[model samples]
Target: MTRFLPPVTIALAALVLWQLVSFIAGSHSVSGVVETMAYLFRMMQQESFWLDVAESGTAIFYAICLSMLFGWALGVVIGLNRNVSDVSEPILVTFYSLPKVTLYPLVLLLFGLGLSAKVAFGVMHGLVPICLITGNAIRQLRPVYIRTAKVMRLSRSSVTFHVVLPAILPELISSLRIGLSLSILGVLIGEMFASKRGLGFAAVNAMGLGDGTRIMAIGVFLSVCAISINFLLLEIESAIRHRTARI
Candidate 1:
């Protein structure tokens, strides 16, 4: 399937290119592909590594869920009103463009530099993309659907849940993919800036100590973690879409 082959092909090509470049450069700064991969395998054997991975994963999941829930609700509200959407567009653009990391200090002060702060930071970054995408998708929904639903005397909740939500789901899934990637990056950076233990923390420490192997290893580990989560989410999204379509 193209779905599966594309990732595998890209991954293989990247690995070959990386190995060639690392080999030719002869500088130990960037690790060779094989060495980094071996280190990643070693990391998988450690219970503590999985625990740290789990911590970051849990925080990311919570943040994304909160972001999507709030964003979708707000987007529907704003999108339903032309005047409100127009007035808020500039403000929303500013928030989206601003770097989320800049607010970490304030968040740290409020949430005290723990999982909560990391999760909150992730939410800020994730919510903007989701909200914008959702709003845009809402605007494209057919007026005919609304008219027909009204003529049929559909309840407000029924119209929204049955019609609006289903129509926008494909777009929501796309936004969700983007939001997940951004949240993962945000969570890792948040961990680097503030956490005691995480893959990001390990990478940071490795960099400071000039442990090039560990640095490369941790980078690979993070990549694998990100890839796995993305794949899992994609699978879940596909399954849900199929089930919903059948209904």
Candidate 2:
């Protein structure tokens, strides 16, 4: 209960303030929390709304999975090879620093304007950070750990599975948490920019029609999904950290 206080308080206060401002302004641009919830509840029963949700969810899911798989492989290679890391570190840093949105046009050209484009956009947004975090995590492993593995005559695979994997598990989880959020953001932006389908498109349509209630509903839905995912991942990360500490 205590852990929930701050967010609950802030939420309640924000709702009250929103309602107050809406009342004073007498404008349709901002909606009360109740109005938004009513629209969301109505939307929950709509088949089309569910279809958009499914599309967006599936795209982001694939993006996250791809990000994790490829990011881990590439990051491990870079971390394990000093020459490769030296040659590629600057390139990765530069790409990661760029606004991912800038790549949307190129991604669209490569993947087309379909669901493929959306998934590719999401992967691009998510992959870099995960790769960077994983590479750094492995690079920072203690020299003693490597020496012990070598002294034990562990095969490369054995050392990776036993030592490197466990050591970097926490960082991987942290990167995933951030990457998932970024992937979702990327997918939504991609959908809004080019697709006729998805929650992002729905939100865009609502905005064009000046449907403040629907806009608010979509915003709240996305926020809830992000918070729930992050919270679950956070618990897992904390558990890994605790176990690592004990080990």
Report the lDDT tens digits of candidate 1 across residue range 1-247. 8778987999999999988888887648777987887877888798988988888888899989988899888887776678888988789889888887888899999999788998899998898888888888889988888788899999977887887888888778878888888888888889889898767787788788998878877787777867887777778778878887898
- The segments of candidate 2 whose C-alpha lies over 4 angstroms from its true place after superposition are none
Candidate 1's C-alpha runs over 4 A off are 1-7, 231-247
Cα deviation in Å at residue 204, candidate 2?
1.0
Q: Rate the local accuracy (lDDT) of all candidates.
A: 0.84, 0.90
Give me candidate 1's TM-score against the actual structure. 0.89
Which number leads on TM-score? 2
Which candidate comes out best when scored by lDDT? 2
Note the residue pairs that clash in candidate 2. none
Q: Compose the digit string of candidate 2's lDDT tens values, residues 1-247.
A: 9999998999899889988987886647787778888889999899999999999999999999999999888888888888998998999989888888887899989988888999999998899888888888999999888889999999988888888887889898998998898899999999888899999999999989989889889999999889999999999999999988987
